[model samples]
Target: MLVDSHCHLDFPDFAEELDAVVDRARQAGVGRMVTICTYLSRFDRILAVAERYDDVLCSLGVHPHQAAEEIGGVTVERLVELSRHPKVIGLGETGLDYFYDKSPRDIQQECFRRHIRASVETGLPLIIHTRDADDDTMRIVREEAAGQPVKGLLHCFSSGRQLAEDALDFGFSLSLSGIVTFKKSEELRDIVRDVPLDRILVETDAPYLAPVPFRGKRNEPAYVAHTAACVAEVKGVDAAELARRTTENFFRLFDRADPSRQAAA
Candidate 1:
């Protein structure tokens, strides 16, 4: 079975059809999903979603885009505190995003560092979101990880091969999103082909970036199969094997998520 390692089920896009969305995911062989909390203030809503669905786990942190708004509130202490929940499996869909510049670069870096510290303290793998800031992202992850060994996954990775190589060197996993299925993502597909299967994971980042044939449409966890199939084809492996390997990789990186818990669900 496949696992959608990152998604935002709390988003209003799925509000009325969450049950149906999840059912579709199950029917598509997506046995589990991890809903991401982009803003700490709305964590209760995110947590409530996780509590409602046994197969849906979650992460906590402030997205880089919202860093300025969460200043003084996105503390390592607060992140560690919220992460104590049994279903909170990771930290920070957080990292640099120079593409949007939604928040000042410095503030985003500071917030990213705090989340990394929280991940180190909590022993939860960090869920990173990076775009057009590979140098800074790499430097911060490498610097902070040097002080304290940390585990993390580069979520929705669509960066340069050098960044992918650097992150892998730091012992981090790369999660592929529906973007990789786009026809223009030849570079990304090349990166996927080179990445070791054991260090790969799959996600939909649903309500956005739906895979091919479903492009320009609202994405859901069920569509992870298409992304997985694309990655599998690029890697010269069968879809089922890719699912098994990515599921294993998911559990390995997000160790806080219990496999038995999914079975029980």
Candidate 2:
């Protein structure tokens, strides 16, 4: 079965039809999903969604865009505390996002580092989101790795080859989103072609970045299959094999969400 390793099921876009959306995902063969948290203030909403669905899990984080606004309230201790919940499996969709620069670069960097520290302490994988700040992102991740081994997934990856190479070098998995399926994403497809199959995961980043045939439309976990199919083509593997590997990679990185663990529990 496939897993939408990253999504935002708590967002209002899905509030009206969350059950249907999840059902459609199951119908499309997606067995699990991880709903991401962007703001510490909205974490209750994220947690509520995860708690409601057995197949859904959540992450605790402050998106780079909200770093400044939430910086005062987001501490490594607090992140670690919230992550103690069974449904909270990862940390931060957090990193640098120079493209928006909604938060000051320094604050974003500080927040990212704090989240990294929390991940180190809790042993939970980080769900990183970097955009137009590859150099800074790489530098921070590399610096943090020097202190302790850092492990995580680069969620909705749509960055340069250098960042991709650096992430893999640091033993972080790269998650593919529908962005890789766009007609103009040849460069991204090329990057995927070169990335090792074992280091790959697939996501929908739902309510955003829908794949072709569904492009410009509201995306959902069900659409991860399209991204998987595209990546399979790039990797020269069968679609089913790609799904199996990515799902396996997802569990390997986000072990808290592993089905085997749940079964044992």
Candidate 3:
């Protein structure tokens, strides 16, 4: 079985045929998925998706791009409180995004730190979304995790090798998205080859980056298999083996997700 470790099912792209979309994922061997919440205010919608699907889980927290808007609202206490829901398995698709800078750099950093604290407190793995801010992201993760156990994954990892190495050293997992299957992602495929199979996860970040053979089309959890196949090829492993390893890694990182639940489904 395969798990799409991070996605946004609450997004409107799948609103019309949500059930069919999920069925397609299951048919494609994607037995599980974690629908990430980018906006805390819209978390109820995310939770509804998880509640509606037997194999789907959800996270709580805001993305860095909306840091300014959710400043006082996206608190560690609030995140921890919402995470009490059995279906809520992780925290934050939160991290720095210097490429867009939709929010001030300081706000983004502060928001990220808050989410880290929530992850540390709740024992829920953090689903980080970092872009064009590797130095700050690494520094903050290191600083926050200092002398304490912090669990998290760098979701949709498209950062530098140093960041990948640093995240691994920090006992964090790296999640590959459909971006890895692109023709120009040869360097990324090289990075995948170096990543320990036990520390890798796969995602589609659906309604966005779709894998090759389906690139430029609307993405969904079903396309995660394509990304996994590509990564498996690069790592010289059978696609099934890669799927098993990644599914194991996903369960390891997001401990709240009961593996038996997927089996029951």
lDDT of 2 by residue, 144-181 (tens): 76768778988889998999998898889999999999
The predicted structure with the larger TM-score, 1 or 2, is 2
Give the TM-scores of the predictions, in the order they appear. 0.97, 0.98, 0.97
Estimate the lDDT of model 1: 0.92
- The 10-residue segment of model 2 with minimum total lDDT is 141-150
Q: What is the C-alpha lDDT of each candidate?
A: 0.92, 0.92, 0.90
Q: Cα RMSD to native, each candidate?
A: 1.8, 1.0, 1.9
lDDT of 3 by residue, 79-171 (tens): 888999989888889999999999999999999999999888989888889999988998998898787999888999988899999999989
Clashes of each: 0, 0, 0
Q: What TM-score number comes out for model 3? A: 0.97
TM-score (C-alpha, index-matched) for candidate 2? 0.98
Ten consecutive residues with minimal summed lDDT in candidate 1? 256-265
The Cα error of candidate 3 at residue 44, in Å, is 0.7
